[model samples]
Target: MKGWRARLGFLVPPGNPTVEPEMQALAPQGVSLHFTRMTASGPAGTHEGQEERNRSQIDSIESCSALLAMVSPQVIVMAHTATSYTLGSAAEAALVARIEQLSGTRFITAFGSVLAALEHLNVRRIAYATPYNEVTTLQGKRHLEEQGIEVVSYGQLANVRNIYEENDERAYAIARAVDRPDADAVFLSGVGMPTLDALQVLENDLGKPVISAASAMMWNALRVAGVQHSHSGYGRLLS
Candidate 1:
C-alpha cells in the first residue's frame, strides 16, 4: 500500500459484478477502489415472499460498516440503491451516521449520491427506468419525490425474479423504455441492473443528461475521496 493513492471502499452484493469495474473505469488516476462483499444479491424469491428479501438487506449495513473499519480507507461506499430506497430517508440518515461513527471515515450511498448528483446538475424533472417491479420502482420514485425531485414518468422492465441474470441488453432496453419527452433528465435506477456501458448511447439518442446508479455512485465516491479529476465519457456528473 506504499505510495498508493486514497482507497475507496464499496460494500457491494456478492452477486453484483458491474459496479466495481464501472467505478474502476471512471475513477481518476490516483484513486483505487476496493470492495467488501455482503450476502445480498437481489430481493426476489417466491411470488409471495418478496418481503423477506427486503428484510435481509438491513443486516448488511452493520457488518459492512465494521468491515470498512478494518481497511481504514478514506471513504466507505454503499453500493446498494435498494437498501436506501427500502429503508427510507430517516433510516438511511441513521445508517450513514452509524457507519461514520463506527468507522470514523466518510461514507456515501448510491441513493444519496444520485440525489447529490441531481442537485449538482440542477435536475428538477426526471424520468426514471428500472428493472425492478412496480412496487419497488414506485418506492424509488416516492423517495426521490420526497427529496423534491419531480418524477414525471417512469418505466420498469418488471423483472422481479432472478435480478442477477440482468445484463446489458435489459439495461439498454429499459433505458429506451423509460425515455420520455417531458422529462428534463433521466435516472436509470437499480445498482444490480447494468447501465454504465450504455449511458453514452442513451444520452446521445435522448439528447439530454442521463444518470445511472453506477455512474452517480462513482462520482459521489470520488467527490467524497476529495479527488479532483474531471472525468469524461460518463455523463455531465462526471464531466
Candidate 2:
C-alpha cells in the first residue's frame, strides 16, 4: 500500500541528479515516485558535446518508457524538458499519444507540464530562465511561442560547467534575474538544475508566480494520477 493513492513514474535523463530528489520532496503522502533513467551516451557535463548527449537521451525514450511501463505507474513523466525542443512543439502530442498507446498508461513531459501549469495559472507572458546552452535555450523559447505563450524576457545561467551540479541558490538567482514586472510569471526550464527550493522564495520576492519544469512536472503528474494534492512552500501550482 506504499502508493495506494497514486504512483507517479518519471522517465529521467541518465546524468540528471536533481529531478528524483526534488520530486520526492514535493510528493504528498500516499503518492510515490518511481524513476527510469534514459540513455546518455555522448558526454557528461561539457557544453561542447551537449547536443550529442541530448540526442542520445531522447533516442532511447521509447525503450526506457517500455521498461518503465512494467511497473504500471498511473502517470509517467518524461522529466527532461529540452527533449521537447528536439521533438518540436508540433510533435509533442504525437509522442505522448504514441507512448500512452504503447504502454496503456498516461504520458507527460517536463516541457508540457510547464505549459500546463502556466495555463492553469493564466500566465500569458513569462520571463524564462535556464541552465542550457544558447541553442537549447532558444529552442525552449521557440517552443513556448509556438504554444502562444510569450517569452517577455529570458536568461541563461553563466559559468554553468554542469547543469546537474547546480543548486537552489543558483536556481533562485537566475529566476529572479530574468523576471520583469510585465511578465505574468517566471519559468525555470531545466530538469537538472534544482529549482523547487527556489520556487517559493522567488514567488515571494518577485510578487509573482515562479514556475519551474521540475515543480510543474510533479504537480501535473499528481493531477494525472488522480491525487488531489497541495502542499505550500513550493509554489502556487502545488499549493
Candidate 3:
C-alpha cells in the first residue's frame, strides 16, 4: 500500500516550485508526500512584500489546515521558511500549538525543522545562504541567532529575479562561496530555492555538513511521523 509507513502533508506557497520535487525525491520508501498550496501570494520573483505574504498564509492557516487534515496525514508542515522569520519564535510556538489543536495533527515549520536538524548535528555555527533580499536575509540570520545558532557568514543570491526559478547550480555556487573554515555546516535557508541535488556535492567539497530547508524539513517530517530512516548519498541530516 502507498504510504504504508506514513503520509506526510505539506502546505506551501502557490508560487513555490521547489519544495514538492526536492522533498518527494528524498522521502523514504513507503512514505508518501502530499501537498496543497496555501492561500499565499504577493510580490513574486524575489521575496518582496514577504511580510504581507507571511501574514496571508498565517491568516489562512486554520482553513488550510482543516482542508489538509481531511487526508489524515501523520504530520503537516508549514513549508514556508519566511513565515517563521516573520512570526518570531514565541509567536511561532503559539502558531504551532494552535495549528496542532485545530488540525488534530502535529504541525512543524521549515525553520523549526532546520533548527532541530542543526541541533541534532551539534552545529554551533553555520555559513548561511538564501535567495532573499538583504532585509529578509538578515531577518533569517537574526532568527537563528535568537535560537543560539550563529551565522558566521551569510549571503543571498545575486540578482535573483525569482527564488522558485533558481536551479541547483546557483544554490551550489552561493553555498560554496559563503562557507567558512570555522563554521560547522553550510545552511541553505530557503524552501523555494532548490538544494537537494547540491547538498551532497557541497558537503564533499567543503568537508562538512550541508543542509537546506528542503532537506531539513523532509528529515524532520519523517522523524515526527515515527519513521526509521538512514538515507545515504544525501547530506548527513538524512543519513
lDDT per residue (tens digit) for residues 1-239 in model 3: 35289989999887888888788788888888888888867665466777788888888888888888998899999998988998898999999999999889999999999999999999999999998999888989999999999999999999888887899999999999999899999999888888888999998899999999999989999999999998887788888
Q: Give the range where candidate 3 is weakest over 10 consecutive residues by summed lDDT.
A: 40-49
- Of models 1 and 3, which has the larger lDDT? 3
**TM-scores of all candidate predictions against the true structure:** 0.91, 0.96, 0.96
Deviation from native of the Cα of residue 82 in model 3, angstroms: 0.9
TM-score of 2: 0.96
Range of the 10 consecutive residues with the lowest summed lDDT in candidate 1: 42-51
lDDT of 3 at 194: 84
Clash tally, candidates in order: 0, 0, 0
Clashing pairs in 1: none
Q: Write the per-residue lDDT of candidate 2 for residues 1-239, one digit (tens) a residue.
A: 46388878898887778877888898888886789888887656556777777788777878988888888889999998888987897677888999999999899999889988999999989999999989989988999999999999999999988888889999999988898989999999988888888989998899999989988998899888888978899988889
lDDT (C-alpha) at residue 173 in model 3? 97
Name the Cα RMSD for model 2.
Answer: 1.3
State the C-alpha lDDT per candidate. Answer: 0.79, 0.88, 0.89
Model 3 residue 104 distance off true place after TM-score fit, in angstroms: 1.3
